[model samples]
Target: MGGQISVRGVTHVYTNRYTRETVLALEDISFEVEQGEFVCIIGPSGCGKSTLLYLIAGLMRPSMGEILVDGRPVTGPGPDRGMVFQEFAILPWRTVWRNISHGLEIQGVPKEKRDEIVRHYIRLIGLEGFENKYPYELSGGMKQRVALARTLACNPKVVLMDEPFAALDVQTRITLRTELLKISLQLSNTILFVTHSVDEAALLGDRVIVLTRRPGRVKEIVRNPIPRAARDEHTMENPAFIEYRNHLFYSVRSEVQVAEHEALVRG
Candidate 1:
């Protein structure tokens, strides 16, 4: 079964306790992610990229409208919708292998079966040698890999990522992006990635969804014409990649300017 997501006229609002004010985070947000499609969301800071992810993940609900996965309303967080955050949420005390097995253990998968599944993903994420290492002993990328492996180990239908690679160095981010692309294709999991980097969005997303500054709303949803099979080093050098990157860059830059202008006006 493929993972398909539908968001209909979603509007989310929050209250500021200190200021005793209401904040409109997302406004009239509407989009649909097809089964097995990879979609990236990018926008200016405070544009509610993460907020949208949270809504879709059912970590919280929109003050209005609804989010559906596989035609069913998303009422709460479930194993079908897994999330990987910027911070490596892996347990520091556990070894990489144990960390990956944590979810399976919770589900009461037998030790032997859980270990088998964990070993496969450890190898899949290139943590074979470091399986015995704890989070502190691993680099940022490796720690993130453990987190990824753990999430994938649960076999989630739709993976929601909130800047999972933002903290990594440039080289590490690039390498992991490639690895993640490969893994996603192999697994055919639907992904909704929230990112600030235009290049990253263009490179990984089948379609890039851009939002306006604050009170985020979909500004544009640009389909990547570049075929996934062609998105290699050669493709990066190709004109199409540069063109798409520039396209998204400009789209986001305009919103960023508007945000800055509003900030200046407030000041």
Candidate 2:
């Protein structure tokens, strides 16, 4: 089952060890992601998008407030949450099959069950023929598919993706977005995806949360008017898609300008 996530009055402060310089990364960020929902977060470069994702993943803790997954406080990384980073992050030494099965092995899933799960995800991500190939032998997009399959094979309640497709070329990124939509629909996985692309957010998110520049705060949450089943490449050409894209672009652009001005003043 997919997990519901609640971020309550969260705030984070980062302190540089060497300089002792502290920066407020996120403040009073409160939001709830419904079970099985695909939510996207977008903000300026310095805005705490990835920071918030890490907090939810239990890789880091907030200075204030709390994050809960399914009414349980997230104290640290656990099996219930899976993370796919921008980097391929798959083990070089392991072939595609081995990489996808690694997490199940750690969880002590029997070899037979692990094999079943690994093969399922391999097909789900369309890497059926490449299962024996190592990461170095795969293309960038193929490697990312392996990374994603590795995360999905474990059946985590929540999937946290931090720009999982940012490194791919335009065509590959587009293709993966569609594949991701399909996977999410088939598995009903609750996902929190962070990306800088307004178009991506508009295309994939049921709701898009926009954040301000520094000390990122929830500026707005826009719901996509386009139905999930209808969001395909052709959907981008629809009037509603264009309108949503334009709205998000303007929202993010405004924050980008403010962040740039702040940087100039600091300089």
Candidate 3:
């Protein structure tokens, strides 16, 4: 397993010069993603969920606190931290194999070694047969597999996902969400996933971290200590699963409702 992630009171503030206003996107946010744990953050849209991902990925600096990986602060993006976004984020011009190994290619990995890693991840993501295809020829899910394989090829300590399946249709999202858990286990890597779906969060998370609306803050963290059996949709129909899902839904549902009302009131 890879190293863990420690976010210590990380605050992100956005400033707009035109209005001379400052927006606190995240305030006093602190959480720990243990090694090999699948933790998901969910909240209303524009609530700084993506902002938090940026902080952990070293894409942006937090205004008030620090984000660290295994006790070391993340000053910049590194191989230890790999990300897969909502968009496919693949190079359309490159072949599937080339896109998967783009990171290694950039890192000066030799063609032989890069090809092997590409093949490994292609198999890992079950895209072995499509190695030579272009992303344009693939479905949304297949494109995402290419993206996931690309990130996995880097062999990061943690995989940070930002609503990676949100763009897909309901069925595809559900399928991928389930597959993601399988992928997480097969890789045994730590993951911090951000999403808007309570069902999705509860379905995949080892721990679900709920955040508040704008100026996002951790509201409640629910531990899904019960592991779900793989490939069994029956778990979702189980009373225990229903209770867990409802509990999470009711927990965050009101906050989301309030945020919506507030938005309409402002408009």
lDDT (CA) per prediction: 0.92, 0.93, 0.86
Candidate 3 C-alpha lDDT tens digits along 1-267: 556989999999999979979998999999888898889998878889999998899998899998889989999988899999999999999989989989998889899988888888888778877878998899999998888888888888989999899889999888888787777777767888999899888888888998988889999999874684442445678687788889889878878899889889999
Candidate 2 per-residue C-alpha lDDT over 37-105 given as tens digits, one digit per residue, 9 for 90 to 100? 999999998789999999999999899999999999999999999999999889999999999999999
* TM-score against native, each model: 0.97, 0.97, 0.94
Deviating ranges (above 4 Å) for candidate 2: 265-267
**Model 3 backbone overlap count:** 0
**Clash count for each candidate, listed in order shown:** 0, 0, 0
lDDT of 1 at 100: 97
Model 3 CA lDDT for position 183? 74
**Candidate 1 runs further than 4 Å off:** 17-19
For model 2, what is the C-alpha lDDT against the true structure?
0.93
lDDT of 2 at 228: 80
Candidate 3: Cα lDDT at 97:
90
Error of 1 at 42 (Å): 0.2
